[model samples]
Target chain A: MKTIWFHLMPYPELPDDFTDEHRSVWVDIDPALFDARVGHRMYNEYIDELEFAASVGFDGVGINEHHSNAYGLMPSPNLIAAALARTCPDAALVVLGDSVALYNPPIRVAEEFAMLDCISGGRLVAGFPVGTPMDTLYAYGNNPATLRERYHEGIELILKAWTADDVFSFNGKYSKLRYVNCWPRPAQKPHPPIWIPGGGSVDTWEWCARVGYSYLYLSYFGYKAALKTMQGFWKCVEDAGRPANPFQAGFAQFFGVADSEAEAIELYREPAEYFFNRCLHVYPGFADPPGYKTLNTVRNGAEGMVERAAREANERAAQAAKKAERKAAQQSFSAASHMSFEQMVEKGYVIVGNPDQVAEKTVEMAKQLRIGHVMSLCHFGNMSRDLAMHNTELMATKVLPQIRHLWDDEWEDEWWPQPLPASDRVMPSPRPTVSR
Target chain B: MIDLAQWKAGSLEIWREGEGRTVGYLHGMVCAPGRQPFVTELASRGFEVVAPSLPGYSRTAPSDDIRNIHDWVFALSEIIDVAGLAGAPMVASSTGAMLALELAAVRPEAFSSLVLVAPLGLWRDDLPVADPFSTTLSGQRALLTKDPTTTALFFEDHESGDALVDATIQRYTARTATASLVWPLPEFGLSQRIHRVSCPVTLVWGSDDQIIDPSYADSFAACLRDVRGRHVVNGAGHLAEWDDPSAVASIAASALN
Candidate 1:
């Protein structure tokens, strides 16, 4: 099984002088302060870390996109992936994908992906996601009604642009292009492998299965929640009668390793809460914009989550009906909910333990699910660079090799790089000699 | 000849009228009978103006199901298709301004021009305007009317009694109002897509509008590459048409040319 590290690299300090109590009050954070201080450091550190992951023997490094939030600073994962392409020689730079519908001329995605593929020597796994409703409908202001249509159209145009040797014209309901030609055509003939990261949309699962694209179930909620989504994906694949290409399916999970399970749990607890409580504090209205309102997000089950949060808030409000009582309860809730490591493990939000235990549990999960790719997020919300590096080294040296041996060692060359013609290849120029 | 009549779009009854030189009307939340006067004023200027009752307002049936701005656009498009005025200009006011902009983005060829009057979708974090519908009739009157005396005169012309005024205020403050405010606007990336619009656009603003600042007009004008012109009526609040009918009519007439 190929091991990929997904890093969010959350900021340590929040600009609001407000305590954790204040931060927990509302989800909508001001981006002005977030961008001013830690943004540049976070970007540089994340790049360096991912590049280091390549050197340390991780097969791939994952970068994802999110907008207007401090939780995930990478609004443009492609930009990070391009930088990774230059820095990491051997590791696959996975742009866990672009939100295709957001781009006006999604051909820009095609061109950029192609350029990245060439630059990385065909080590690009292009991920196209139908984006979250908050990002696509609220942030970007796309009509929810036309989102699926627009996404499919954008994907078709991108694919055609990548593969077609000659220029072509497309006139779709949303996008119309006079000429379709993407320069720096991907080094991988017929374009790089396409991965569709779905947020449990039925239409998306069926579409990915039909189109022969890899389906990645990003584990946002607990493992049990992710299990149902992954089961649905596998069922779709089975129903379609598509051969299980090992590379055609993957899963991402948060992981933290320490000297012991107790310590590991303690280390990951706050970060997991930060990801869920802080990062996922999207405005309720923004979750399912009217036109793009789906049964999954709008139905009773989906509405329950918001209702639960609101109910909790209401209860807190009622307890605080008197200013003094409210203040006392707020203080108690703040102190009590500091998020211990054991709770995070129980929540299934993270895999935290010694290297041996983590490795064993990871292998058990993969074997049980029969998944080929295990994407681990070792560096998450507000984790220090040194700590992340320690975790990465442990994962590379102790955990990965053990799990790797579990898979068939016959050297499956299906995902291996194909040989390029001498005329098509460009050798690196010699470095300039410097006086030391 | 332009046919003027009320028709049904799905579950909602739309007060759609006009044919040859078509203009779609988006009435404000608390619009009353006098709202038709703006339609008449536009009609007199040699243009067909169809002011459809927003889902819960006026003769239009109230819809608990309508969730977002695009749903309103779908209803608007159905009216345009039914009336065979698919290739007509739209003059949307307040909330309707957002709907009109969405329609233009979704189907750019449907209209020749879009006239948005004090549109409400753009919200800046720094603005001091509290919720427009939170106040009492008198409080709302103070906020919406640029001049208190002029506002009293306008209300005297429209509001028959305390009962009618209260009912109007209640209708405007229902769950529908909350839905309109909460429903996410289309992220057509219109700021970028505006340049792709094949038709002309005209933004009409009340110079003293408190709901949305006139400063926003510059951004709108800058983004809309095909804007024919922008006219700001003086001494008007958010509802420019009601404040100065002649000025709004003249702006509509200018766009027709």
Candidate 2:
């Protein structure tokens, strides 16, 4: 059995200067508040933290992509991955992906991945994603009908471009390429490890199993939702009669660690609210594009989404009706309608506690879901830079080491890179010793 | 000859050589001959129109499951591919506008130009309206019509009784509107990717549109890098084509020419 690999990706916080009373309104926030100089500084600081994670023995550092949204400012994870490739010596630079469907000629992805692999000396974990329906169809204007086809087509092109030795001409339903020759082939033999991130899509699980790619389940809901999806994935694997490779399966969750469970929960309450209440306010229209509808979306169903929006709409209407009914009635309703923190905790959308409690719960989840890798969002919501760093450091120093003993013999160490050759290695500058 | 009435009644109807052109029209949510005039008028203007009822909309049988945007795109793309009109310009209004824009963006080689009228997918946070589908007919009516006077305009020519039409509108609105709200916004970030669209795009807005704001026109123009032109028609709201058909048709003609 392999030791569990823990990865942390921090969402850089927006400047404190920006404020919106109608923050719940459209997903727009003033971009002017973002100091470009500070952004550059923060970028360097974020990379330094990820590097520190590697120095402290984290298996990997993660990065993801989002567009025109204030929540996650990284619209291009590849740029971040490139920077990390130089800073982090041991950790795998996981670009949880460049959405294949969004790219015009996905060959650019192949070329970029190859370049990253070369620069990192073979420490790149390439992620190809189908992307969320809202992002693919509404955001990118990709035809919903051709989304799956184009995505699969892009992947085929990317894989061929990565592994092929000869120039290739390819024509497909969505993309056509002539003489697809990519330079700087990946440092890894068949190509860098491929991971496909999905939100409970059946086709994605089946395809990942068939191709021997790692299936990373990104569970924004909670552990319970993720457990069901991972179980479904394993069943798919069993149905296919493929060996259950623990290394090939992973899951991610939002986590925060502190001195005590009470302190952690208290510290995380506001940021968690920012993530769920504030960041989750996507207009319903952008979620479902034409063509991108998969069976899973149908299964997870629109009724829930519809009901939530309808309920919210109805509640507003009812509130307005109440006001019209009587001002006193409106006051009574407003006074009565307050959601407590305990109610939110019961919902299981966020988990905050000390390292011991977080580790215990995480291990319990891993055991239940059979997940080998856990991508922890230690830095989330509007968590301050200092708080995020503290959480990351705490997870590294305490939580991970505690869990390490549990799965130490599970996986072989052969997967990790060997010591660099003398000619390829560079020694760090020595520091003078000081006696205090 | 394609019988406009039959076509509107949910049959597969194709007409070639009428006004020296061929066109297709997929009726909105419910299959009704009354909507055929919208397609026929476009044909009269020397343009081929193609509109197929979606699986759960109009006279077409509802699919076993309500599919995502991909299903509609695939159906439309197949229709365009088979018709050999891959190079023809398309005009899509209201809900259809989203599909038209997506088709043009995804497979630009198949289209010469795209015209979107009061298109969906431009939800602003500041808007006070509720999703048309999530609410009741009366609730939606209140949000959509600025005043009670304008509310009567929707029923003026509708032969369907006010009650029946209102029910149909609610169901259609709820289904599509609910579908939109279920997915994440970044998934619809085509505003940034509109630059990748190779074909010309012309966005038309109804000046008094109560459902979607005219200000969205600026956002659309900013996002769609290849826009040919944008026009805002006065005295028109969400259904500018029906509210002021002549103006809408003229703008479509200009874009086509």
Candidate 3:
């Protein structure tokens, strides 16, 4: 299995009463709450952590994009990827990735990604995600009804820009460029490997299966909850009659590893609680705009229809039950926020244990799901620089070695980046390692 | 009696009633006009009513061709022509009124006159329009109408035989069309084109409208080339026609005559 270290780079210092007083952590989050001085230090600290993860011999280091959000601070993952490309030469620069539709002309992505691949010497895993509803629809002001359409068109335009030998005049519904040519074409042949980080959209699953791109399910609720979505993707692959190469899939999970289970719990409890509570405290109003969810996702099946019909017959009781149901559904994240650290562990929202235990759980999850890539989120909400280093180093020294050889003997990883030979590469100056 | 029929090769769902002079009706963000009391009242006033559901807002599925405000204006103009309501005095409400004005701005003679009820094509920095798409479903209902009865009758899921799935799809379809037109903000450069509407226009609003404030009646009246007058129906919200059907229909009928 290929283990990639991912960072969300959340703001570490929210007020103690932030959840009590604030309406949301995104979209309409209070601007006054953010301090630029703190952000400056935090950014460098985060970049340092990503470098540290790479230094500890992790196969890859990753970043992603989010807009108008406190957590996942890289609004432009490419900028951070550029920084990593120069310094972390051995580690794959995984940008899990740009929200393609947000760019005007979207060739900006093609240009920028190509530049990163060149700078990193052909080590770039380009992630194309249909952005979260909050980022794309609300913050970026893309119409929900046409967002997916624009996104699909944007991806087509980008892929064509990357590979077309001759300059082409493209007339698309959302964007039209008369002269289309991407300068400084990607270092990797036919562009970097495309990994789609998705949220269980059936259309995305089918598209990934058909296109032979890696489908990465970013698990917020952890591996147990991720079972259905991962199963759904494998089903799509099976139906498409494609090989069930584990490398075709990747899954993200939050991890907290230590010398002992109790130590792991103690170290990770605050950050885990902070992440589930505040970072995920998104306003329900900003979620799932009108056409953000497709009709297939919205419509209840025939059995559900019959059930709904019966429920409609007993209107008052049904309404009362529905109100309760809606409340529970809306509060699902908040419910996680309020959960004790023990509850989060039991639910598998966060995997916390000694190295052997953590490795065992990870291996069990990867094997069960037929996953070749395990994206480890070792640094999360409000975790200090020293503690984060401890988590990453322990995972690297003890945990990764145990799981790294899982799918290697049986399946080849065709999706990973193929960097140029080290002898031919331009090297940066080696910095003295920081002692924690 | 109102009849439901399909137009444009079964791609448009239209409601038609009465048998005299044609009065083209355009519906707002929520329900189709097939069973609205205002459409019934307008028909009883001795004029033919042709109400075509805006694409994706009713039984008609969303068309890929109609993607933006410009396409919407073109589509509405086509509907007006195909429904045989060209040069007829038009009655439009909310999101439909927004499209009606956009069409009139460019086509001019598309409608003989227009009685627009709380249209949502203008924005003010100080009094920004309340966004229905950015709020909860209950919050959207509250913004649409002031009366709980109207909310229950139209917005709530209380009908006996209707499947919840169908109702949910209906609501989502309506929202998709409406959001496509007016989401983020309703302003689609209508302020720049409002002066080009050659036909006379009568603006009406609910006194208690929250979506686009009733005060915006002045904003529209100020820019329109030929404004007959502006009327505010008391004890109503954005969907004034639903709250006080007789008052809204009477105002619309009087304006058209």
Strongest candidate by DockQ: 3
Q: For residue A176, what is the lDDT in candidate 2? A: 83
Over 4 Å off in model 2, which ranges? A1-28, A299-345, A405-436, B1-257
Interface RMSD of each: 10.0, 8.8, 0.9
Candidate 2 has a TM-score of 0.65
Which DockQ-derived CAPRI band holds candidate 1?
incorrect
Question: TM-score, each model?
Answer: 0.66, 0.65, 0.92
Error of 1 at A406 (Å): 4.8
- Where's the lowest-lDDT run of ten residues in candidate 3 chain A? A301-310
CA lDDT, candidate 2, residue A66: 62
RMSD of 2: 9.9
Clashing pairs in 1: A141-B186, A141-B187, A141-B188, A142-B187, A144-A291, A144-A292, A145-A291, A265-A341, A320-A326
Where does model 2 sit among the CAPRI classes? incorrect
Best by lDDT: 3
lDDT of 1 by residue, B1-257 (tens): 22334546233334543434666666653445224556777777776666555555443554434445555667667756765557777777776676666667778887777777876655455663344433335555665657655445334445456655544443433323433543343232446445555678788888888767877777777766687888889889877887787788788878776
Quantify how close model 1 is to the true structure by its C-alpha RMSD in Å: 10.4
The model with the greater DockQ, 1 or 3, is 3
lDDT of 1 by residue, A167-253 (tens): 989997678889887897988888788888766666566777788787777755546446666676778788899765555677887
Model 1 ranges with Cα > 4 A deviation: A15-28, A35-37, A244-246, A266-285, A293-333, A336-338, A405-430, B1-257
Rank list by lDDT = 3, 1, 2
- Sort by DockQ, best first: what order? 3, 2, 1
